[model samples]
Structure formats: C-alpha cells, structure tokens
Target: MSGLIGKKIGMTSLYNADGQALACTVIEAGPCVVTHVKTQDTDGYQAVQLGYGEKKEKRTTKPLLGHFKKAGTTPKRKLVEFKTFERELSLGETLQAADVFVEGDFIDVVGTVKGRGFQGVVKRHGFGGVGGQTHGQHNRARHPGSIGACSFPSRVFKGIRMAGRMGGNRVKVQNLRVLKVLSEQNLIVVSGSVPGAKNSFLILDK
Candidate 1:
C-alpha cells in the first residue's frame, strides 16, 4: 500500500457507529501531483515523484521554478517520491487522500519526531539512580551509578546508554489503523499518535 503526502493537523476524538469515542490523528492528505516518473531503464528503479503544498513563486528558487514548470504545476513547498507504487499513475496526475486509503486499513506513518535537547541519564536512558537521599547521597540523584567494572576493560564500552540529544529524527510508527477517511475535508483520521508536531510532513505506506 501507499499514501499521498500530508501534514499532521493534530488529533481528536470521534464517535464510531457503535457510539464509542475513538482517538484519531487528523492529517491533511494531498491532491498530490505527480511531478516526475522514474523508470527502470533510465533510473534503474521505479518510482513516482509527488509534489504537495503550495508556496509563493517568489519564495521558490529559479531551479525549482523550472522544475515545477516542466511538470506544469505551480511552485510547491515540498516534493517527495513514493517507491513501489501500487497504482499506475502518470505525470501531472492528481492523487487524493480518498484514492489511497480506507477505514480499517493498516499503514506505516513516517515523520520527524519532536526534539528534546540534552536530557540526563534518568530521562534519556531510563536509569534508576541511587534511590535514597537519606544515606549521605550528596548529589547522586540522577547520576549513572557505575559505568563499568573496576578494571576489567579499564574503560567504558562503546554504545553504553548515555544522556544526549533526544528525538528530532526520522521515525516510523507502523501498523497504525486508519479509523476514518474524511474525503470532503481531505483529512485522514488514523488510530494513534504520529511523529512530529502539528503540520509536519508525513509519509504513509502499507
């Protein structure tokens, strides 16, 4: 399965046919335009390049301007390619949210996660530091207890979980159910939380 490019508009609750409130993620899927087609003979791969979201002509560079003009489309803010597309689509073709998905379908959503800068061992690595403040534990509340054995390796092994930057990376949430498809509003209501904050680019796949 495949999906058009979209922006996550956030999440909300909706009542199903059985009157149970279900949580759903609202994304503004496209009427994405096919900008270019990659063929096996030329590119050694098969894929379709899609353009989504609009930007002012002045904001787009001249190179991009020529590219969009070749595709006969206005300057778009984002362009993404979808590989192994199931449908036979062509350049200048428009793909809407309704054409890609339906209720109860499982999809994988990929996006950049929200950034959390420079976290400590407890928050970043989930380490339970020394648990008592009463026993002369001066400032070892969130410190990593023991890095390594006394003189076994004489140094900490690589890849030991440590505090550092968190999030702000490409993340894929897989097997999320499509709860609703609001074609009228060009919205897709998925079953759970997706990566990134509001209005982030999301790629959906089956």
Candidate 2:
C-alpha cells in the first residue's frame, strides 16, 4: 500500500520492440517530504504522511506553516498518508519518485474525473433514444422514454439511470503498467490513459 502523490503532466506515445506506438500518461511523481509519522501506540494506526508540490507562505495557514517547519521543509500543496512502505521512513525525510516505483511495476491510479457539469441522457448514460423519427416521434429522438408504470409502483424507481451531473468523481484505474521512471526528471510514464485533466493530483498506489 505504498505509493506517491503525483500530478498528471500530459500524455505521450512510445514505440515498442515491434515499432508499435503505445499511448502513455506522464506524471510528475514526488520528491515529497515526509511530513508526519503515525504509529499504533500513538495514533492507534500506522501511516506515513507525505507532502508534495510547493505553495506560498501567504497561501498557507499558520498551523500548516508550523507543521511544515517541524518537518524541515517549505509549504507544500498536497498531503497524503500511506499505510506502509518498503523501507522505513522518518519524519522530515524526503522521498523521490524513483525511490518508490520502478519500470514494469503495475500501479493503481486514483484521481478525480474531469468535471462535465450537467449533461443529458445520451451523453451521460449511453441511452438509445427513440431510434427512428417514425410514429409521430418528431421531437423525441434523445428522450429517456417511459419512466413509470401506470398505477403500479407509481413513482419512478430509485437507481433508474437518468442524466444529471456527470464526471467530477473519484475514480481508480487499476493495474496500469509503469513504462518508465525518469528519476532525474521526477517523472513516471505509465501505460494507457489516466482520468482527469492535466495538472490534476493523482494517487499512485502499489
């Protein structure tokens, strides 16, 4: 359950042995600072809190400023707690992306899907609207036809798929293979597409 907090940089393509192009996501993984350490005896749990990205002092609260100062680091933009690590980590210690992941590793990426605001049924639920415009169906093409029964359980049923809000939800894309780990650049290239737009925070878990 060890991982790092990363920022989705963008996507790129790579050619394999057969010269086939493969799409990959590029993430700026951490050179995160170990902000806090929790032990069973102290907090009734075990977790290592790491901080990533840089934020200004003016933007940070007084309490958070003190917390970062105690860790011997500057203000950070993100804080995440991991349950365990391959190696013991001390408070105030720094961890690079290469230290936690390697090439060929399969990792799960957690992120918020891009916000789509309000959407209709066709776009939201893959609904097959009234197929043809026959039978006086002039303006009913993309409608979610017939929501209720006549006098039988009268109300529209709960859990019936209807269009409302879409996206902007937490999602986990699992078992994406790690294609490359550029330690010098603090970047990790992973196979396939990742959720959310560029610069969104992602939790990469192993």
Best by TM-score: 2
Worst 10 residues of 1 by lDDT: 82-91
Q: Count clashing residue pairs per candidate.
A: 0, 0
Residues 1-206 of candidate 2 have per-residue lDDT tens digits of 89999999999999999999999999999989999999999999999999999999999999999999999999999999999998899989988899999999999999999999988899999999977989888999898888889888879889988879999999999999999999999999999999999999999998
lDDT of 1 by residue, 65-150 (tens): 99888888998878888886777987788888888888888999999999999898999888998787877998999988887887
TM-scores, all models, native as reference: 0.92, 0.97
At residue 144, what lDDT does model 2 achieve?
A: 88
The C-alpha RMSD of each candidate to the native structure, in angstroms, is 1.7, 0.9
lDDT, model 2: 0.94
Kindly state the number of residue pairs that clash in model 1: 0
Candidates' lDDT values, in order?
0.87, 0.94
